[model samples]
Target: MENFTPSISVSSQVTHSLLARLLALAYVDQEVDLREVELIYGIALERGVSKETLESIMLRPHSVSTILPSTPHERVSHLYDLARLILADGIIKEEERAMLRRSVLLYEFTEENADGIVDFLLEQAQAGVAPAQVIQVVQESI
Candidate 1:
């Protein structure tokens, strides 16, 4: 892991994370589109998440391994951003919910704290909160 060097950009990492969450949400209700795959791949390339990693994330139908926290604010903000994007279509897909649950695991959040995170995400998703506001909330909480 120490030797692993991602070739993708910082912006792309953020983008890829959001895209992954969205795809997972889309997957909940139905099959994913080719365009979605292409979009994810493109973002993955830019974000440095290998094609294999992207595939694993896309293929994950349920919870994934614990996410070693990089930064509390970043992890929470990503979750918020994803939740917002998932609800942007005005319906919460099962795939998205599953992905969010899996994401919580991947983000390595504490079991007790995960519920709060989920609550915050659901609230933001339902309320149509702005991404900026979501970030602000995550930042303040962190």
Candidate 2:
């Protein structure tokens, strides 16, 4: 094992973590739609995550830790992505909403503000507001 080293990079790890959570959110409704899978795969690919790594995480999401980005902007951008994924299939189940609440907490938002944040993000996502624009709005408000 002297020469052995972990192949996954820090960036890849973050990608894995994010994809895992997205996958979990997609599965919350007991049905993983093709749209959801496509969205997740698209994100993984954009982040330069290998197909093998993506598949591994997809097969075992629980193995990956829930590690959000360090910066507040990155975290909120991720939250927006999660909200976007929740609306991908054109239906938002109560289960999805609950999962998003838990995700908001994981993203380091206060419990008191989780609902409002989630609602706002969901509304923005539904309105087709771009992620960058949302990030700008959030950062300005802070």
Candidate 3:
């Protein structure tokens, strides 16, 4: 085992971690739409996650090994992506809010900041703010 190198790369794992977490959020409402699936796949490809890895993770997101980014900024980016997912169906489900709230702590945000940002993001989404713009505001505001 001294020279063993896993076939999956570190970047792939990181993308998988992000994808898996987002997949979990996607499922909390017990419905997955084509648009949401397409967006997740597109984002995963952009992040260097192999199609095979993404497919496997989608098959069993809860079992995925999560390796969340270390920096607060990176973690916050993941939160933004998740918040964008909430807007995928054009209607934010209550289950999505609950999952996002749970994720705030999972990503290590302080309760106060997490609560504030999630609320702000939802309002932004409702107000038709683009995800990128919301991300910018969140990154700056938090």
Top candidate (lDDT): 2
Model 2 agreement with the true structure over 1-142: per-residue lDDT tens digits = 4897867677667777888888889889889899998988877776677788889988888799977788888889888889989989987789999989988998899999999999999999899898889999999999
Show how many residue pairs clash in every candidate, following the order shown.
Answer: 3, 0, 0
Instruction: List the candidate numbers ranked by TM-score, top first.
Output: 2, 3, 1
lDDT of 3 by residue, 2-65 (tens): 7866667665677788898888777778888877888788778767776887888878877778
TM-score of each: 0.59, 0.91, 0.81
Candidate 3 contains a number of clashing pairs equal to 0
| lDDT for each candidate structure | 0.64, 0.86, 0.77
- After superposing all C-alphas onto the true structure, candidate 3 shows an RMSD in angstroms of 2.6
* lDDT of model 3, residue 119: 87
Clashing pairs in 1: 25-96, 28-95, 67-106
Query: Per-residue alpha-carbon lDDT of model 1 for 1-142, expressed as tens digits?
Result: 4787767555555555555565665566676556545645654665466787677666763434333336676676667755755565566666677677777877788877776777779788689676567878777766
